[model samples]
Target: MRIKRPRIRQKIIFTLERQLVKGAHYQLLLLAALIGLISIVGGILVMPSGEPTSTFGESVWWAFLRLSDPGYLGDDQGNWRRFISTLITVAGYVVFLGSLVAVITTWMNRKIRHLEQGLTPVTANNHILILGWSNRTIHIAAEIFQSVGRIRRFLEKYDAKKLQLIILSEEVSSFQMQELKDHPMIGTRAHEIVLRTGLAIDREHLRRVDSLNASCVIVPSLAYGRKELISPDIETIKCLLSLNAEAQAQNNQDLPYVVAEIQDENKINAARRSYTGPLEVIGSNTIISRLMAQNIRHPGLSAVYNEILSQVDDNNLFSQVFPELTGQPMGRLKRAFTRAVVLGIVKSEGEHFSPQLNLPDDYLLEDDVLLVLLAKNSTDLVWRKDRISTDYAPMPFLGMLPVEELENRINILVLGWNEHVPALIRELCTYEDEKYFIRLVGLRPIAEREKELAFLSENGDRVVVENVVADFIRESEIRKLAAETFDHILMVSSDRMEEEEEADARTMVGYVLLEEVLEKASKRPSVLLELSDPSNESLIRRFQSEVIISPMVLSHLLAGIALQRELNSIYNELFTVGGAEIIFRNLPEYGLSSGKKRFDELESLASAHGETILGVYLDRPDASGNHLLLNPAKSHEIGLSDNDRFVVLTTFY
Candidate 1:
C-alpha cells in the first residue's frame, strides 16, 4: 500500500502559490498592462459615436497622446473628435495617479525600514552583522557564529536569550551563494542564528536586518587575496570612507561600533576613518604574525593556541582573569574561573608574565586585561567568598618543570610568500631550543629576512635557513629537493594575487604535495599552512596541524577585537610580551589519564609555587579527529595522558 503522490497540476499550483507571495510585483505589472489596454479598447469600440472605427495602430497613437499630453482643442470641437478624446484626454490626471502609486510604494519601503530598526524577527536586536565578501568571510562568520552560539547557550541558562548574527555579502556569483546555503549550524547559539544575503553596501538590504541597530558588527579579514579595481590598500581606503559617510548620514557616525578588515597594513588609517564611535579589527594577521612565527618555531604551540582561539564550548576557550582571583599564580587561574582555565596574564608592571610564577603572591595581571580561557565569552566573576572558605584545595608542589623539558628542536620547510616572514622568524629565534633546530627551506632569501638572519647568526644563535632551490609548485621538484629534510612543513602566500589563475595553480600544487608527503611519511611532520584563503583552512584541516590565515579577513577581526574594551589589553599582554610563552605538558597528578579539566588546580599549586597553568588539551572526540577542546569546566575531569600546558610567564629573550 504505497501512498499516492500529488499530480502534476497540484504540484504546479503549490509551486506557484509559494512563488506568488514573493513575485507578486511581476504578476501585477502584467495584469495592469492587460486591464489598462482592455478598458481603452473596449470603451473606444462601444462609444455610440456614429463615426467609422479606426485601426489598431490609430488607437494606439491616440492613446499615447491622451495619456501623456492631451492637447485640448477649442471647447466647440467637432463631435467625432470630442467623442474620441473626452474619455481619456487627461495628461495631468494620469501623471498624478502614477505619482500617487510611487509615493505609496516609497511609504511602504520606509515602513519596512522602520521595522528593520528593531531586529530581524529571528535574530532580535542583540545579533551581530557581518559585512563585505571575502574568503575569510566564511571562516570568520563561522567562528563568530560559533562564538556567539556558545555565549548564547551560557546566557540561556541564566537569561534565556542569546546573541545572534546576520551576514551581508557582495553578490559574487551563484557558486558563492550556493556555498552559503549549504552551511547548517553557523551561529550555533540557541537564539543565535545567521542570515546571509548578497546585498552589499546598499542600505535597503541592511535595513532588512537592522544593521546599525545590532549590538555589534564584524567585518572579518580576507583569508585569501580578493581582487579589487584599485590597489587593495587604496580600495580599502575608498570603500571605508564611503561607508563612514553613509553611517554619518543617519547620525550614526559615532553611534554604532564597526569592525572591518583591511588588506594592506598601510590602509589601516583609512579603516580608522570609516569606524563609527568605537571599532575593532578582529583577525589582524599582521600583528598576529609575530605570534604565529613564534608558535610555529615551537612544536605544540599550535595545540595551545587552538584552545584559546576556538569557539567550541559554552565556556570561552579564552577569558580574562579578574583581580579578585588572588594568591593563585598563572597556572592556577585555569581552574579558578568556573571550569575555565588561564593561559597567561598581562602584568600591571608590564614586566613579568610567567604561567609558572610565585603563587600566594599578588598575581600581576594586566591592569587593562586578563587573558583567560572559558567555553564562552565570560564566566560569573563574582568572588565566591563562601566557596573560598569552604573549598580551598591545596596540593603540595614538587618542583618547577624547566622550559627545556619539551622537545623543541624542529627543522621546518615553508613554501610560498608572506610579508611577515622576517619578523616571524626573528621572534622564533628567541626560543633557544627551536633556534638551534630550524632550517628555512625555500629558494632565495627575502631581503628583509637576510638582515635579521645575519644578525641572529652573528650573535651565536644557530639560525640557518638551508634554501633548497626549487619551485614548491612543481610536483617533481618537491621530491627532488630533500623532501624529508625538515621536522615540520608550512606553506604560505608571499604576495597578493597578481592574477587569479596563477595563484590557484600554485595552491593546487602545494595542496597535492602536502597530501603526497602525508601519504608516504611514517612521521607525518606537523604541517601548518598559511593558505590563499581562509575558506581553504577547512580543506587543509583534513590533514593536520594546518591553519590558513587570510590577512584581509583577519584585519577585520582585529578591528572588532580592538573595539572590545579590555580585550585589546589582554591580547597585547598575551602576545606582545617578549618572554611570554605558552606550552603543553603532561600532568596527571591533577586527575584522569588524558583530556581537558584541571580548572581547579592552580590555586593551591600556585600558592606553593609561582607556576601558572594556561590551558590543557585532551584527545577529545570531535569532527577534527579528537579535537583539543579548550577551557573545560571544573567538573570536567581528565585522564593521565592529557597534555597540561603551564605558561611560565618568562621571556624567551
Candidate 2:
C-alpha cells in the first residue's frame, strides 16, 4: 500500500492556521491589506464630477487619508464621493484600526506577563548559572560573594562592572527571587543576579540563560515533591547531559565547568559518564557522614575544616607559585614565611596537581611546585626577612606523653536514623586501636537495622552495632537507652520530615531530653547535633553541643569548588581517610611549661613529634567563647593550661 502525503493546498492551510494561532500579528496584517485594497478600488470608481479627475496614485492617497480619519468625508464635493469615503472609514474602524489596537495591546500584555513569569531570556556573558532552586541556593550564593579573591579575579578578567549570577528554576516564586536579590550578603556584593523560571533540562531554557557564555554551572540536587520517582542524582545527570549536548551542538570551544550535587553515591558513576567536560559531582550524604564520623573521633575538628573551607575570614588555605624559593628545602620554606604557615607543596603531576604535606626537610622543592600556605589573605604570602629571627633554638625530639587512663571501650548513642547512618558507621570503623559500641535508637524495624549492621560488622573490625526500636521524641524512650553510659551522643536529623523546622524541632526535643538525663550523672557525655537549617545554629548554640549543619557545609563546599576548581583535590585529601588528618592533642602531652611559650617553639616541638602545629585551642574560652585560632603570628605568646589542646596535622587518625 502506498501512503499519500498531504496536498500542497492542505499544507498551505495548515501553515496559515499555525501562524494565526501562534500570534495575532498575522491576522491583523491580512485585515489591513484587505481594507487598503477595498479603499483603493472604491476611491478609483466613485469620483465626484465637480472634483478634479484623479490618477490611480492620487485616488489611493485620498483613500488612505479618508480611512485614517472619518472627517475627510466632509470635504467631499458630492454625495457619491462622501458615500465612498464613509464606506472606507467604516471598514477602517471595523477592521484595520480596531484590529491594530487589539494586536498592539495583546503584544504589550504578553511582554508584561513574560516579565512577571521570568520567561525573558537573559543577555549576559561570563555569568555563573545555577540550575536548581532550594533552601541551600541562598547560602551558596552568599558563599560565592564571600570568596573575595575569586570574585575580584573574575571581574578583572571579564572587565565587567559586576559579576552576574543567573538562576534557572521553575519552582522559585517572584517573592523568593526578590528576597534573594535583597539579601544582605548577596546584595552587598559587586554582582547582579537574574532569575528565569524554566526547567533546567529544557534546551530553550538553557539558551535563554546564555549557557554557552557562562563561566560555570551549578546543578544542585532537586528536593521537590513527596517521593522522588526520579531521584535527584538522575535529574542532575539529565541536566548535565542536556548542557553537554547544547554545548556540542553550538561547537563551543570551551565548555564551562559544571559542579553537580548528587544524593546517591551509586548514581555518581552514571552522572560522570554523561558529561565530557570538567565536572565535579559532590555526594552530600557521603561527605557529611565522613565529616560527622571524623568529628566524633576528634572533637572540635569541624572548626578546623570550617576555617579552611570558608573565605570570609583571613585564615584560609591559599596556593601560590614562588619562583624564588623553587629549589629551597620544604623546612626552609616553612621558616621563611613568619606570618603564614606552610602546609604543603602543590606538585603538578601530568594533568592534575596534588598536595604533598609534611615533606622531609632535605626534600628540595621543584620549580613547578606551588606552595600551599595558611594565611589571613593572599597578600600575606610575601616572605618577610625581618620577621624570621635567629634567636629560636631547636627543640629535642622528646616523645609524646603516655595516654591518660580512661575507659577502654567507647559507647556511642545515635538518636535517629537516615540514609547517612550507614555511611557514618562505615567511616567510624576506619579508625584503629578503638573499640566502638554504637547503639542506634530509632523507629525502624530491628531486622532492617540489623541488616545494615551485619554488613558493617562483616566489612569492619572492632566495631559493635545495636539498634532499639523506639520513638526518640519521647523522653522515656530516650532515657531508656542509658544516656549517661554512652561516651558520646549523636543526634541525626529525620529525612521523613520534609519540613526543616519540624525535623529540627524533633532533634531539639531529643537534645533536651538527653541533657536532662545526663545532668544528674557524674560525667556528662559530649553531644553532636545534626541540623538541616544553618540559621538555627544560633538558637541551638546555648546547649553547648557540637552542631553540624550539613546543608550549610555542603553549600560552602560547592561554592568553594565553583570558585576554584583546583580546590576539589584539596578537600578530597582533607576529608577522606588514609592521608593526613586534622586531630587535637592535649597541650600537656608536649611537656610544655605553664608560662608563656613562643609560637615557633611550639611548632618546633610539634615537628619533633612528627606532626605540624596549626594552632591551639584554649581550655578556657575567650570573650566570644571561640577556642581555635589557626596560623597565629610567630611572635605571639600562648599561655597554656593543663587542659589546653593543640590542633595538629598528623598521619595517624
Candidate 3:
C-alpha cells in the first residue's frame, strides 16, 4: 500500500522554531514600513487645489512638493498647504521611530552573540576535557573519543551511545567542528561549536572547562600573539600556574591530569621547576624542527605523519608498560617494539623535556613512565606474511616490510631559520647512525643572520652548512635542491605574521616551494610544512602536504592547564620521554590468531623474547588500525594477518 505524504508545511516544520523567536524590533520594523507607506501616500493625496488641481490627481501632485517646505504653497497652493504640512509631521514620526529601533536592534544582536559565547558543563565524569580552540584541540578530542569509546566497549564495555566529551572555547565554530560533527562515532546529534574566547592566563575562564574534573588536559604548542607585549608562552605559563593554585584550594581528591605543550626548552625547564602536579609539555620547536628537517630532506615525512596521526579503524594506538624490561636491555626489546614499530618510551625517573634529544637511559625499562604506540591487540604480536591459504589469512594487521627490499638510510634537509633549529639539529644528530645519514644543505661561513642556524648545528659545527643562497620560494631554486637524492624536506616559516598577511604569505610561499620541489623532481619524496596559523591549514593541505605543524593549536591546549603548570610536564612524559609513540607491527597468517587464542600463550612467546604487548591492528593503515582490539577479552577472536601491523608501547624499546 502507498503511504500518504505529509503536508508540505508539516513536513518542513523544524525543532529550531522553539530555539528562535522573532525579536520585538522586527515587529517595530513591520509597523514602520506600514507608517512610511502611509506617509508617502498621504503626502501625494494632500496636493493643493491649484489651476491644475481641478483633477483629483492634479491636486495630489501639487501637494506632494509642498510637504517638505511652505515654498510650494506660495503659487496659489491655497488650503492644500495645510494638508502638506500634516503629511510631513506623520513622516517625521515614522522616520524617528524607525531609526531608534534600528540602533536598538544592533545593540541587542551584539549582546546575544556575547551571551552565546559562554559554556555548558557536561554531566559526564572521567571524560577528557579539551580547552581553548585550535587544530590540535580537534585532534585531541578525536583521540580521546576513540580512546574512551573503546575503553567503554572492551574495558567497561559500556554502550557507545552515551560517550561524553566537553570542549570549552569561544572560538569553536561549526566550520572548525566539521570533523567532529561528521564522525558517526560521537553517537549524538550535531551541534555547531565555538568556544567562548578567553585569555589562557584568565583563571575564571579556565574554570569553564572544569579542568579539575577532566581525565586529561592537552595544552598544545603555541598561540600567535602578534602585536602584543605578552607572548602566548607567558600567557600559558600564568594560566597553568593559576590552575594549580585553584586545584590546591579545592582540595579535590580526584583532580584530572594535565597535558600541555612547551614551545621553548628554557621555559619548559622553568615550568618543571614550578609545578609539581601531573603535567607534560610537548616541545614545539624540537618536534617541529626535527620534522621540518626530515620533510626538507625526504618528502615521505608527510606520509609518515599521516600514518602516525591517522585514527580511522584497526589503526588505533595502544600504550603499555613493559614489566620484563626492568632487568633487560632495551636492545633486546627493540625486536618487540620494532616488530610492531614502537615509537618512543617514557622515562622512568624524571620527566623528559625533548624527545628529539633524549635516548633511553640504562634505566628506560626501570622508569615509571609508560611506553605507547599502535598495536594489533593487547596480546603479544605475531609476524606472518610468508604463507598464504585458500581461507582468510590470519594476523594481517602488520604492514610487514618485504625481506628482499632493503631499508634505506633516512635523508633530512632543513630550510628557513628559527631558534628551534639548533635544538632540532642537536637532537637529530644524536639519532644518526648506521641506519640514517644526515647532511646540512646551506651556506658556509654563515652570515650574522645565519647565527640561529649556527647555534642549531653546534654539534655539526665543524661540518660547515652548505651556503646555498637560493630563495626557497623560487621553483627553480627548489628544483636544484630536489635534484640531489633525499628522502624528505621540511619547510619552516618562522617569519612574523605582524603584517597581518606576512605570516600567511611566507607560509604559502614555503608550502609552494616545497610542493614545487617535489613536483619538478623526477623522483617524488616526502614533504612536511609548518606554519603559525590554523586558519590557513586548508590552503597548505591543498599542496598535498603530508606533515604541517601549527604552534597555534598547541597554544589553545596550553590554556586548559590549572595553577600547577603541569601541561609541559605531561608532554615531556608522553612525547619527549617516550611515554607515547606510534608503531607498526605484523600479524601471522597460517596460524589461528583469534581472541579465542590464549593471550598468555602469545604473551609468553613475545615475553620469552621480551616483547610488551599493548594493542592489535588489522593492517589497515588509513583506517587507523581500528580492527585490532586492545586488551582484548580471553575469548575475543584475533582478526589479524602478516600483511597487517600492530602498534606497541614497551618500556624496553
Candidate 4:
C-alpha cells in the first residue's frame, strides 16, 4: 500500500522546524523572516495622529525602529499607535533580540570548540611540517628560525610566499601554543607558524596539515613515557609510512623531503624502507656515542662542533657550485675566497653527492663540483679571482714528519649510565691501538651493566670496563669519584627520572659536585656533560666544560640535513672512527715555531703532509669571545707560538 503525502501547510511547518534545528545560521534566518512579517503587519496597522503626513514607507520604517529598539515605544501618541507599538516591542524582545543573541552565542561557542579540536585543515603550501613534539619541539623551531641562509633559499626554491612551520601533534594544548608564541621569531611573525592536533600515523590526520605539499617533514623521536614500552622508532616509521601512503597517488617530484630520527641503529634501515622518497634517517644513539668517544679523545672538540653547528655562530659550513673556478686545483683554491675557507669539493653522482674533503693538492675541480666552504655567511663565499695572483709562487713541499704518539693508556671516569655508554665503549674500543680504562658509577646494579656490555668481554686488550653501583645525585659519592686520577670524565643524563628537566637537574648537580671536588685536586680531568634539556645549557656555561645538549644537537643536525641532505654523510664521516677527523696540532709539530707566516702558506705546508689547515686555536680568546678562529683570510699574517695550535682535518688511522 502507498503512503499518503502530507498537506502543504504541514510540510511547511516541518520544513521550518528542520531549518531552525539545522544550525545558528539557519535559526537566525528564520528569526529574521518572522521579524520581517511582524514589522510589515505593524507598519500597515498603525499611524500616529501627531504625524498625519507619514507615508506607507515611512510607517514601515517607524515599525522597524520600534521593533528593533524599546526606546521608540514611548514616542507613540494615539491609543491605536501605542497598542500596535507595544505588541511589536513584546514580539521583538522575545523573538528578535533574544533569538539573535542566542544565535550569536551559539555560533561563537561552535567556533571556539572547533579551534580547540584543531580539526581544521591548514591551507599553507611549501611549509615545514613537524609531525611529533616533545621537549625538543622548541629547539627544532628555534634552529629552523636561526637557519637564515637555508630557510631563505628553501622558500625561493619552492616559490613559497612566506616561510611557514606547521606542527601536527596528538593534542594542541594551550601551554604548547603559548610556548611557541613566546618565541622571539614566532612572536613577531605570528603567521609563520601553524599548530594542529592529530595522530601522525593516520593518513586522514596527515592531510590536515597538508603534509604532502610541505617542503620538508621532520619526525623527531618521542620521549619515553611511564609504562610505555614501544620504541620511538616504531612511531617514526609509522609516520613515514603514512606519509608515503598519502603521497603514493601523487607525482614523485611533488613529495616532500623527510628527515626522521630513529633512536635505534637497527631500526634506521626499517625507517628508510618505509618511506620511498627523499629521506634522511638520523641514528641518535650512534651519533651521541661517537660524539662522546670523540670528546674523551679531544677535550675541547665539543665546543668546536657546537660552534660550527650552531646557527647563531659566526662560522658555518656552506656549499656552492662555483663554475668560474672549474679546472683550478684544490691546493690553489685555498686563496680563492677572501672570507671563506675552502674545506673540500662536493662531487655530484647523478642523484647523490659525495664530499671529498682535504683532497690531494693536484686534484683539480671539475664542472658542476661544489666548493665545501666554512664561512660566516654564503655571501662571504665570494670567488676572489684577484686573490689568486698569476705571479704567486708555490711554496716548496716540506718533508713529512713522523706521527706524534698520544697518551696510550688513559683512565676515563663515567658519572652516569644509559644505553649510550655501551656504544661509547665500543666506539672507544675501535681505536684498538690504544688502551682505555673505563670506570662507570651509576644507580643501576653492576650486574645489569655487565650483562648489557657482555659482548665487549673479549676486547679486554683494548678497553677495561669497571662498574660501581652508586647514586650520582649524592654529593659525597661524586666527591669520592672526582678525587680519583682520571684522564677524562663523562656525565650522562640520568634516565631514571620520569621528566627531562629532572634528569637534567640531576646531571647538572653531579657536574657541580665533580667540579667542586676537582677544584682541590692537583690535576683536573676533562669533564663532558650530557643534558637532556637544551634550556639547562646556560646553567653550566660558567664551568666551561664540554657540554652536549642532546636535543639541541639533534635539532641542529635535523635542520642541517633538511637544508642539505649531503651533510648527513659528511657529519657521519667527521664524527665516526676510521674516517677524517678534526684535530688540533701543536705549532712545533707542524715545523713552525716563531716566524710570521701567511695563512695560505700554512695551508700549503699542511697540504704537503696530507692535511687541511682549518684555522688556529690561540692561547687567549679572539675578538669573537672564543679561543678558536676558523676560516680566516688566506693572506692574513700571524706569528706562531709554543702555545698556538693549528686546527687541521686529517685521516685518523
Candidate 5:
C-alpha cells in the first residue's frame, strides 16, 4: 500500500505538470487556483493575530492584499501577522506574478508567430482576390494600383469605399510579402494588399479570403518555373470549381467577375465549362506568341505594345457606349472628341463582344455599339457635342507615297525553345502571302522539335523550319548560325533550366553571344528577347534590342480586363492577324522632307489614308532622351526629318 501511494503521488505530479504546460490558459487557471488556496489558508492562520481582520471574509481580504502586493507587509502590526504576510507575499511571487508574466509572454509570442504565418482569415467584401503565386503576381498587383482610377469607378457600382487586393498562395513567406510591397509600382499602395497562405483548390482555404464576396478574382497561370502535379490550365479550372462550390455553399447563384489565365489554348474550353459566371480567360501562350510573331514582322513594334499595354502611359484604350452618337459616321468620331481618338467599335454578340476595326470612313455606327477610344484618361472620353456644317472639310496633305513592297522571304534565327515556340511558328504562318525561313537552334534533340512542330510542314511554303541541337550560350555555336544573315533574331528563355532566374541568366548569356557574332557583320538584324523575370530588365537595358517580359505583359492584360471586360476584344483586334495593326513609317515614306509641322496637320493627312498618327519616333534622342513620344498634344509642333518615323495605326500592314 505504501509503495502504491508513492507511485500514485508521482503520477499525480506528472499529470499536473503536463496540464500546466499544455497552454497559457491552463497555466493561468492553475495560477488562479493556487492564489485562491493561499488566500483561504493564510486567512485562517491570520484570524487570531489581527485587529485588521475581524471576520473570515475580512481575514481573507487582509491576506489577499499582502499576497498581491509586497508593500502591504510593512503595515503589519505584530510578529505573527508580519510572518504570515511575508509568507503570502513570497508565495504570490512564484504562483501569481512570475507564472502570469511567463504565460502572457508565451501567449503573445504564439499569436505573433501565427499572424506571421499568414493563416489568419481576411474580412473583406467586394475586394479583388488574386490566387496563386507566380513571377507575374507582383506585377499584376502593380498594374491594378496603376489603374486605380478605373478601379475606383468599378467600385462605385458596389458602393465600396476603398480598393483591396487579397492574394492567397500555397505558401506565404515574409520575404515574398516584402518583395510585393517593395515593388516600385506598388510602393505606397501596399496597404491595400493582403496576403494569405493556402491552396486555391481547397474549399477551406477559399473561405479564408471570402472568395464569394470578392468583386473580381484573378488566377495567374503557374506555367513558369518548376512543373507541378497538374497542368496550369487544369489547376486554374480546379480553382474555379472550388470558387463555384464556395459560392453555392453561400446560396449565391452568381459569382463576381473572374479573370483567369489559361496556359494552353485548347484547355480554355474546359475552363469555360467549369465556371458558369461572368468570366474572362486569357490565353497566355497565344498572346505571347502572337506578340512575338508580330514583333518579328515589324521591328520596334515591341516598344509600341509596351506603351499601349501599360496603364501608367499617357494614352490607353477605353470602350464605352454613347447613345447620343448612334447615327454618326465612324470617321467623324475623331472630330467629336478633342482628347480621345476613336479606334474602333465593339459589337455585342449573343453573350460576348467582338471588336470591329478598320471600318470604311462612311460606316455608320448602330445603336448600343461600344466605341473603343484611345485617351489620356476616362475623363477625356466625353463627347464634345459640336454642330459641324456638312460642307466643312479640312485640306489633306498630298505627300502620301505608294505602299512599300513586302519582302519575298525573311530569314529568322531562333535561339532556344519554349512552350511559345510552336505557337509562334503557327502565328507566323497566319500572315497572308508572307514567307518566313526560320532556323531553330536549341539544346533539345532535332527529332524532338521536329515531332513537336510536325504540323508546320503543311505550311512549308509559307514557313521553312530547320532545327539544330546546339548550345546557344556558347559564342562558337552562335557564330555558326550566321545570325547577321537573318532579318530577325529571337532569343527565347530556355525551359531546360529549373529556376526562372537561372533561365534568364542563360538567356542573357545567349544574347551577349548573338551580339558578339553580329558585331563584324554588315547587316544588323532586329533582336527580340523573351525574359521571365522583370527584375532582369535593368541589367539588359544597355543592349540595343526589343525585350518582351511575357509575364509582365500578361499581367497588364489580366489586370486591365479584370477592370473592364471590353479590353479583351480591343487587345485581340490589335494583336490578332488580319486586323488593324501598328506600323512605323519614315518621313520619306510619307513623301515629306525635313520640316516642322503641327501634329494636327499630320493627323488630318493620315485620316485621308485610313491611318491614325499615334506619335513620332525621333531620329535622335531629344532633351528628354526619349526615342518614342506617343499621344502628344494635337496642336504641338514636331520637327520632322527624313530619318524620323511616324508611328501609325493602320490596316495597311
Candidate 6:
C-alpha cells in the first residue's frame, strides 16, 4: 500500500512539472505562490524578543514588508529572527523579481519580432488593396500616387487627408518592404501604406486587410521568383477563389471591384469562374501585341497612346453629359464646346456600348449619349451657348481614298517568342488585301511554335509564318536573317526568362546586334522593341526604334482604373478592334495646302472627312526634339508640310 501511494504522488508531481514547462504564465504564477507561502510561514515563525507575541496576520504583514524591502530588517533583535528576515528578502530578489523581469523581457521581444515579421493585421477602411509583389508594383504604386496628386491639384472638395494602401504578399521580406516604403515615389506616401507578409490565397490573411471594406483590389501577376507556380494566372485564380469564398461566407453580396492582370487570354474565362463579382481582367500580353501591331502599321502613334493613357499633366480622355447640346447635329456639337475636341458619341447597343466616331453631319442625338472628348481637364469642357448654332449647313460625308497597296509582299521579322507572338501574327493577318510573310527567330524549335499557332493557320491564309531556330543575341545569327530584307523589325522580350533584368538585357543585346547588322545594309527597317522594364527605355532609345514598355503601360491602366472606374470602358473602346482607333493620316489627303493653318480650319476639314483631329506629328523632330503634339489649342496655328501627318481618330472600316 505504501509503495502504491508513492507511485501515485510521483505521477501527480510529474504532471505539474510538465504543465510548468509548457506555459510561461503558469510558471510565473507558481513562483508567485511560492513567494507568498515563504513570506507567510516565515512571519508566523519569527518575532522580536521585546515585542508581544505577534498574531498570525501581524507576522504575515511584517514578513511581507521585509521580503519586499531589505531595509525592514535593520531593527531586528535576535540572530534567528534576523536570519529569517534576510532569507525572505533574498528570496524576493532571486525568485520573484528576477522571474518577473525575465518574463516581461521575453514577452516584449516576442511581440516586437511578430510586428517586424509583418504578421499584424491592418484595420483600415476604404483603402486600396494590392495583392502580390513584382517589379511592376513600384510603377503601379507610382501611378496611383500620380493620380492622387492630380486629384489634389484639381479637385478641391476631395478628402485627401488619409490615403491608405494595404499590400498583401508572401514573398516580400521585412527588409524589402521597408525598402519599398522608403522608395522615392512611395516614401513620400509611406504613412498611407500598410504592408503585410502573407499569401493572398490564405483566408486568415485576407481577413486581416478587411477585404470587404476595400475600395478596390488590384491583383498583379506574381513575380518571376515564384517557381512553384506554373504561371502567374494560376496563382491569381487561386487568390480570386479564396477571396470569393470568404465573401460568400460573410454573406457579402457587394464585393469590392477587382482588377486582375492576366498573362494568358485563354485563362480569362477560368479566372472569371472563380470570382462572382465585378471583375476586370486586363490581358497584358494581348494588349501589348495589339499595341505593337498598331505602332508598326502607323509610325509615331505610340506617343499619342502614351499621352492619352498616362494622366500625368492635364491632357486626358473625358466623358461628359451635356444636356444642353443634346439632340444637336454632330457637326454643330463640335463647335458647341470651345475647349474640348469632341471625339465621338457613346451609345448603348444591347448589352455592349459602342463609340460612333464618324457620324453624319445631320445625325440627331436622340437619347442622352455620352460625349467623348480629349481635354486638358474636365473643367475645360464647358457649354458655349453663344457658339451653338442650328443653321449650319449639312456637309457631305467624305471618305478617304483607298491607299495604294504595294505589289511586293510585306516582310516582318519577330526576334523573340512569347505569348504575344501568336496574337501579333493574327492581328497582322487582319489587314485587307495585304500579304504578310512573318519570320519568327528565337531559341524555340519551329515545330513547338507552329503547334501553338496551329489555330491561326486554319483561320487565316493571308499570313505565312516561318520559324528560324537561332538565338537573335548572336551577331552571326542576326546577320544571317538578312535584316535589310524585312519591312519591319519587331523585338519581343523573352517571357521564359525568370528575371526581368535578364530578359531586358537579352533584348538589349539582340537590338544592338540587329543594329550592327543593319548598318552595313542599304535599307533601314522600322524597328519596334517591346520592353518589360521602363528603366531600360533610355538604353534602347539610342537606336532608331519605337519602344513599348508593356509593364509600365499595364500599370498605368490598372492605376487609372482604380482611381476612375469609368476608364475601363474608355480603354476597352480605344484599344480593341472594330472600334474607333487613333491613326496618323496623310495631311494632303484632307485637301489642306502645305502652309500655316488655324487648328479650327484643320478641325473643320477633319470633321468634313468624318474625323476628329487631335494633333500633328512631324516626320522629323522639331528644334526641341518634339515629334508628336496632342490636344493642341484650337486657335494655335500649325505649319503643315507634305511630309507631316495628322493625328486623328477614325474608324478602321
Q: By how many angstroms RMSD does model 2 differ from the true structure?
A: 5.4
The candidate 6 region of ten consecutive residues with least summed lDDT is 149-158
lDDT of 4 at 485: 91
* Tens digits of per-residue lDDT for model 3, 40-86: 56545553334565565655444444433445444554465555555
lDDT by residue (tens digit), candidate 5, 283-329: 88899999998888778888777777744556778888889888887
Q: Candidate 4 — which pairs collide? A: none
Model 2 misses residue 45 by how many Å? 16
Count clashing residue pairs per candidate: 79, 1, 114, 0, 0, 0
Better of 1 and 3 by lDDT: 1
lDDT of 1 at 71: 60
C-alpha lDDT score of every prediction, in listed order? 0.50, 0.76, 0.48, 0.80, 0.83, 0.76
Candidate 4 segments whose C-alpha is farther than 4 A from its true place: 1-23, 26-67, 75-91, 159-161, 184-187, 223-227, 249-254, 399-407, 445-454, 458-461, 594-597
Each model's RMSD to truth, in Å? 13.5, 5.4, 16.1, 5.3, 3.4, 4.6
Best by lDDT: 5
Cα lDDT of candidate 5 equals 0.83
In candidate 6, stretches whose alpha carbon ends up further than 4 angstroms from where it belongs are 1-102, 116-126, 148-164, 175-185, 223-229, 336-339, 348-352, 358-361, 364-368, 376-386, 389-398, 401-407, 622-624
Question: What is the per-residue lDDT of model 6 for residues 573-646, given as tens digits with 9 covering 90 to 100?
Answer: 67777567777778668876688988877878887777778888877787778777676777778887888898
Ranked by TM-score from best down, the candidates are 5, 4, 6, 2, 1, 3
Higher-scoring candidate on TM-score, 2 or 5: 5
CA lDDT of 180 in candidate 3?
66
Task: Spell out the clash pairs found in candidate 6.
Answer: none
List candidate 2 stretches off by more than 4 Å: 1-21, 27-105, 115-126, 153-162, 188-191, 202-213, 223-229, 247-254, 360-363, 387-407, 444-454, 457-461
Q: TM-score for every candidate vs. truth?
A: 0.60, 0.82, 0.52, 0.86, 0.90, 0.84
- Writing each residue's lDDT as its tens digit, candidate 1 over 454-557 gives 65655354566654445687667777655565677767665556543355557656767767756776666766665554345565555556564444224334
Q: TM-score of the candidate numbered 2? A: 0.82
